[model samples]
Target: MTTLMEKAHAGVVTSEIKRVAASEEVNAETVRKLLADGFLVIPKNINSKSEPIGIGKLMRTKINANVGTSRDNVDIETEVEKARTAEKYGADTIMDLSTGGDLDLIRRRIMDAVSIPVGSVPIYQAAGESIGNMSSDDMFNAVRKHANDGIDFVTVHAGVTQSSFERLKRSDRILDVVSRGGAFTISWMKHNCMENPFYSEYDYLLEMAREYELTLSLGDGMRPGCINDASDRAKFEEFIILGELVKRAREAGVQTLVEGPGHVPIDEIGLSVTAMKHLTGNAPLYLLGPLVTDIAPGYDHITAAMGGAVAGMHGADFLCMTTPSEHLALPDVADIREGTIVTRIAAHAADLTKEGVREKAREADRRMAVARRELNWNRQFGCAIDSEKAKMIHARSRNADTCSMCGELCSIKMMREVMKK
Candidate 1:
């Protein structure tokens, strides 16, 4: 029952390692070394038939799109469409954060709808019954159920312990907590006057993870909800505990990813990303928006993209997409597609400045530049993030050599004639 990390440590280059190596364009041995050192993780459960996705140092920063059913809106077909749309646009992964209506069925349906690795917050399922009714066993059982159902990874807020709670009480913040899982953990602890089961019984959780080779995503329960609350004591306290848990999970040979903040200002995003990586021993960091500004409701996706680019440049490994409906209501399929494409643009922008993947990232831009110079509209469209949209936009111009704005006065065309003279 050796986990993927254990296999990597044993120097066994399994098929997963090979596939990730080929996809990431890194050597298989290098991938194994990084995984063994806990700097990389491939979130593929033993029962999942989904493709392996590498998230960590040396790999391109990946984007994750969340699709699920809320209590008020439980349309399974729409959720499934959202999942498909997310994947089609460029989401490296999918996380089903559905908190309402036949969760198990919704989860299975979403998983069946896509071939990419899928993750979930098991607490969402466990806390559905009622925070008061949720026992420590119920928490652990929910995790096991998702793993058994072939969830590639699960977000566990194991850092929301009694000690972290003390720090939260001491802080004076605008938004105390914005994470649903975090709130649930705190409420459950308050109800039973007990520590979080995920934190208290982490070893038992590790045992189950090893059995299923589950990649545990340590959720950032105390993540800041606003710019003012950035880098608070409560958040760091949780990171300290998560760092220790990360070391233990590595020892137990379970792959792990550490989640990061939600609404950090643009300036603090760098420090926040750096500190989390340092504290967690460079475990792959999966970040929510860490949105630069809190004011944009309809355009939060763009806000998050700005923050994500900076965070990715600063070493954040994975980004969770923030849709246009982030603060509004349930996102439709169009919202999912736009969010996915926008976040991908951010990820690619980050890769251009990133260390390991900079050359590859720049290569794509170089190709586009060459096509532009040659007035190759088709090639430019081919290189675009949204080829269909690019083609559609250009189709309106009718001038194939130059766009509507510049037309016959295009600099690229003008320069070519000037050079010939």
Candidate 2:
């Protein structure tokens, strides 16, 4: 039962490696080397039939859309619709963070509905089952259940240890902890007066991860909630712990990636990303917003995209889509669609500056530019990230060759006439 990492170390290029290689347009050997070195991760649970995706060095920056039901809004059908809509709109992965209803059924339904890798935060289910009476065994059991259920990846707050908790107490941050999983781990630790089980029993966790070839997304439990709390001592302390854990996971031949900050000032996003990458031995970084500003409750998606583009430029490997309802409410299908497209745009925008994929990303922009210059409305829509949205918006304008804003005063048309003369 060799994991992908083990297989790669053995120099065996498996079908997953080939599929990822073809999708990334990189050599199969390059993918093998990256996987073997623990720089690239292809998260495919053995039981999952989802497509293998390469995330990390030399691969296009990927976006993940999170869809799930909260206790207040437990509509499984809507959740499933959001899952399919996310994939259709260009999400590289889907994470079912359902905390209500039958968690297992919802997770499996979402997995069956999409062809991309699926992830989950096991602690959510553990807490749902045993809010105040959660035992160390309960947490481990949740992890095992998700792995056995074929979740491609799982977010474990192994870094929220007693030591980091002490550091958190020493700090006077505006927002101490914003991550739901992080808060859960801290609450369990405090209530039980014990160390975080995931941290204390990491070896056992590693064994289960290896058994399922599960990619451990070492969750940033101490991620800053607001811009004011960015880069605090507690956050960096947790990062140091996660860095050590990253090495341990790699040594154990288990796939892993490090999750990063939630909210960061625009100027600090790049620095934060670089420090995390260096500290974690350049393991793939999956970022949640690092939302550049604290304002814009309704438009957090735009802020997240702005921050994501910067993070990607600074080598962040994956962006988790932050919907307009980020702080307001759970995202509906429309919000999921918009968020996925926006995040995909941000990922591509960052890809334009990346080394290996820059030219490939630029080619799309080039096509869009050509279409615009020629007043090729159809071609423009074809090149858009959301073709339907582009068409819908364009349909508002009566003119076929130009939009409403520049009906007869269209610059492209005027430029064409002058150039022809």
Candidate 3:
């Protein structure tokens, strides 16, 4: 019944650690040490059977795709397809954020559909069921339900306490709180005139997490909703609380990750990422868009990728994909695929600068370069992250060896002929 952290602490390398180590190209003992030190987290609940992934220092930057139903749209099959698409397109994890339909059924269906780790936000269900009148028991029950349904991780806004709320009240934020779960927690606390149950009863929460071996993703409920609100006191106060919660979770042998900002200006991303890493004692940092700008409504995925690449370079361990439909509407399957691929690109871009995986990342680019030099269309497509797209684009040209852009005037072909002489 020992948790993975507990086993790691005892110097016992579990099969999960071995798998993660092998996947990460690190020694099993190294994975064990990192887990024991709370630097890496493998968020596989005991009841869930999925491929283990390592997220933290020395590991490849990971990407997460969110697929779920909203109040206006409730189709379990569509959400399941989104989950499958996310996994097929290389998402490291899938989070079921359904607020409509049977949340339990939707969550279990997503878990059944994908082999990657699945996560959820329990407060959404708590608020959905009670309409903001949820008691502490209602919140705890939602978390327990998710764990029992084999969700590998759950986002708990344990850091959004009354003190953090007071800080928010005193602060000047443009858009205020943008996180749905955060707003739910705040509304519930205000209605009941009580401290956040998750914060006040953290020990109980940790105990349940240990029992299920579920990873706790400390949700950033006070994350800035706009670039103007970035780096405010409320956000930092919640971060400080999350940092302490992380220490407690580690002490209790529960795996943990700290969620980060919603929106931030481009220049502040590095500081935001490093500050979160430092505050949480290097617990694997999971981040939402941290969207650098608010202007690109139709292309927030691009903006988020830009921010994600910078955040990863600065030590963010995990990224949540932001779809093109962000701030607009619920994303369709195509949007999910596009977002997942773009986020993967961002993660790989950052991995090229990271320590352990830089060489591996560079090898792909090297192969692409060599392929381009030889004008090997097949090989070039093979080296591409989206080979189908590459092949499609290449097929547009009438000439097989050279693309339409340059035809016989291709620079690589010219350079090759000169070099051969």
How do the residues 31-150 of candidate 3 rate in per-residue lDDT, one tens digit apiece? 999999999999999899989899998899999999999989999999999999999989999999999999888998899999999999998898866656678998999999999988
Each candidate's TM vs. the true structure? Answer: 0.99, 0.98, 0.99
Per-residue accuracy of model 1 over 1-421 as CA lDDT, tens digit each:
8778888999999999999999989999999999999999999999998999899999999999999999999999999999999999999999999998999999999999999999999999988768998878888899999999999999999999999999999999889988999999999998899888899889999999999989999999999998888899999999999999999999999999999989888888889999999999999999987689999999999999999999999999999999999989989899999999999999999999987899999999999999999999999989999999998888889785899988888999999888895
Write candidate 2's Cα lDDT for 153-208 as tens digits: 99999999999999999999888888999999999988888899999999999999
Question: Model 3: runs farther than 4 Å from truth?
Answer: none
State the TM-score for model 3.
0.99
Name the runs in model 2 displaced over 4 angstroms: none
RMSD of each: 1.0, 1.0, 0.9
- Runs in model 1 deviating more than 4 A are none
Error of model 3, residue 123, in angstroms:
1.0
TM-score for predicted model 1 compared with the true structure: 0.99
